[model samples]
Target: MSGGEGGEEESLEFTPTWVVAAVCFFIIAISFAVERCIHYGGKLLKKKHQRPLFEALQKVKEELMLLGFISLMLTVLQGTLSKMCISEKFVTNMLPCSISDKHKEESAGNNTATMEHLGGLRRLLSESALSQTAYCASKNKVPFLSIEALHHLHVFIFVLAVVHVSFSVLTVLFGGARIRQWKKWEDAIVQQINDTDPSLGHAVTPIHDHAFIKDHFGGIGVHSSILALMHSFCKQFYGAVTKADYLALRLGFIMTHCKSNPKFNFHKYMMRALEDDFKRVVGISWYLWVFVIVFLLVNVNGWHIYFYMAFIPFILLLAIGTKLEHIISELAHEVVEKHVAIEGDLVVKPSDQHFWFSRPQFALILIHFILFQNAFEIGFFFWIWVQYGFHSCILGKVKYILPRLIIGVFVQVLCSYSTLPLYAIVTQMGTNFKKSIFDEHVQAGILGWRAKVKKKHTLKGSLTKPGSSSTDGSTVRIQLGGITQKDAGEIQPVHD
Candidate 1:
């Protein structure tokens, strides 16, 4: 009879448990791979002078981040499911089986047999402990935040940050270093330019310099060739580098910019040059990064998928914030480059009428966008988890999921509350941009503002006038760059 019962139990379905779990893991892996290949790959290809490769990289990164995000969301959905088991605990927890006596019988005995069964529950609890522990510990003992849930979430997030940040920083550093290396190789060319030039250094784009620098040293260039040298290497079949991994890329850009600023001393440049190192040290020293690291350390006890799901919002929000800053910085650079400086000691001349985008307006838009998206997402997350848990609870197996739902609610609420300050920060950033633009354009020449100046003539018979001088002896002069305040009979070059 025992053998027959055992056979019957063996024949019962196990509910395709691994199928869902495996699919979740596979999807996550694929998502990261795609994102890394595209974003990091494009960045690399662009540096290589391979436009095709660069284009490919961008296409890939976009597709990957999108797909990965979707897949991760789906995996989160799958976590609420359970393997259909015969434990009376499920019946008691889900249905009116609490009073059904069978569950009481199951838990009543302190005998060896009952103790053996109790061990299994303990193990299950340990393995499934995710972010919903408090909920899991309640009278109902819902399986909200299981260890498995948090494990996956934590690992995915950690890897994402580490990979992307590292890749970005390394890319920047490598590009910057390579450019420097190439410069060394081009000693002869540099000398030639130096012998005949005073300002040519300002003109050579780092791209061209890279080639010449390497060519001069007889070293096989990593990115040489008019065509793609290793197209296969450029394309990731499974995994590509992520934004977290692109420290080098970021450093390279910083170094490139630092070199251009005349006001930056060697110490300043050095600090910027070693920014990654500083970030590393600070990351280690700072409590937040350390908290994350330590929180990850708890994974050594085991893994939790819920952590992965929880981390999604955090990572996405931070990435969006960083991307916003990058865009703003780019715009700022353009504004600074073409803006004309005047006597006001500012870049833009006073009385400039037209304006496109002020820094403040642009920043405000971004801040609004981020907060809006965050609000919508947090709301959606809560809605999904709550609905799923409530439905499961009605079915008598709410076990772990219900607790997770409540915890999710609390977390979401807290994050929503925090968004207010974040919104303010973004708004302030926008305001600062607006101020910058206004400052640039302040005191600009206006049609109605009459200039009063005294004109003096030198032996050469050239008229000299001070901008602030009274108009007593001086003729009313409407002046701009390349425009002469001399006789109106003389043609003055109009300024744009």
Candidate 2:
């Protein structure tokens, strides 16, 4: 190439579209990381505290930051890309000519100058016009429905933000009330215990027996589970709900157990039922729906970048849902039947063991693998889109949409792959929470049974009384469940 040609090549201007793509990609990556941290933190905290509503509020704050950052990054990137040069071919071949003021002063008649300006203006209009997908792909490069879609997306997120804030306030109120109520009842129980048996009674029960309260309130799970359920219930009530059968099925499974417990308290039953509903909604419904909608929109627009944003979350939602189903079904089976240990690693009951080899568990693993593969396909598609878009943009193929499509896909795949780990981490964290309850305390049973037994033993009367004379005239320790007396007194079996 000659020096002049080299200079021309160096000086040749093109749109800075990659900047927009990069911004979007980074935003998605950061958001996924934040989301993972939030879920992991929730799991760690849920074990320590029963108030999940506070965690939900914290999640809302994180999501708000994500939305704000995404919106701002997209806006700035779009503005930068819009200012880059239109292709020279596009300017010369398609644009209308401008009417020079000098030619008009010279009365150059209806000739080349006027026609040139009109031609340049017409070509500008043509190049700027875009189909919805291409328009969105070329965002600021074109004029069309992309603006409306962008506006709508932001508007939807704003509405979501408002909803989150409202829910956060409601959660605080509900959690405060619930905590206060729990304290009140706990105090009453402690007072009763103190009045009846002065030795063992305390204001709060021992923390070591928290397993009892956990069983009563519902087992450990994501704080999002409860919030997700409340969101689903409102959605169902307002006729915006989906996955209705899944919700009902979970409810049925829980209620089946309730029917066998005639002494079940209504308040406890309702609280537990709601908690279960929340668990299902969070693991399966909320993230899954978000993934589907984002994927469908990306597909319809043919934008590779959006697919990247949608993919990992899509895979994660499926994986987490499968894990949850396995854990829940396994626990449900465990509750209904008593099983004997077969090997140290296995339990055998009348029905089959519901471990990894079981039909349901195998199916769940298969489903997770399938979702993972689908996300991989999305990454491949995004790569192809980006490669083609960059090539075409440099080659000045302004008339074709394929290049822009490729770039969008490239952005999608790049962004999705980078954040895939975070999604996996969050999904695994949620699964771990569900699994922890099973691992630590499945056969732990309710504490009230032991409490009742202790009461009965205490009422049987002291076998040794202070300063009471023993029949054998010897000091003996009086052990209730054993034959021992510490004082010099005969074993008392006084009538009640």
What's the lDDT for all of these models?
0.34, 0.36
* Candidate 1 C-alpha lDDT tens digits along 1-496: 2253323222225536787679889989986786666667767755764443344344334434544574566467645532212333553343212353444444654468645654654344443443244445543455533445444453444343333333333333443343343333234433443576554444323321322122211233333332222321221211122221122222232233332422222222222223322122112123333544554444321144333444444544444334333332232233344543312111111111111253323333332233223332334334433332233221233543444445444433322332222222222222111111111123233223333232232322344344533233334354421122334342211111
Candidate 2, run of 10 with poorest lDDT: 429-438
lDDT for position 246 in model 2 = 24
Best by lDDT: 2
Off by over 4 Å in 2: 1-61, 80-145, 168-172, 175-179, 198-496
Error of 2 at 16 (Å): 32
Q: What are the runs in model 1 whose C-alpha is more than 4 Å off? A: 1-141, 181-190, 197-496
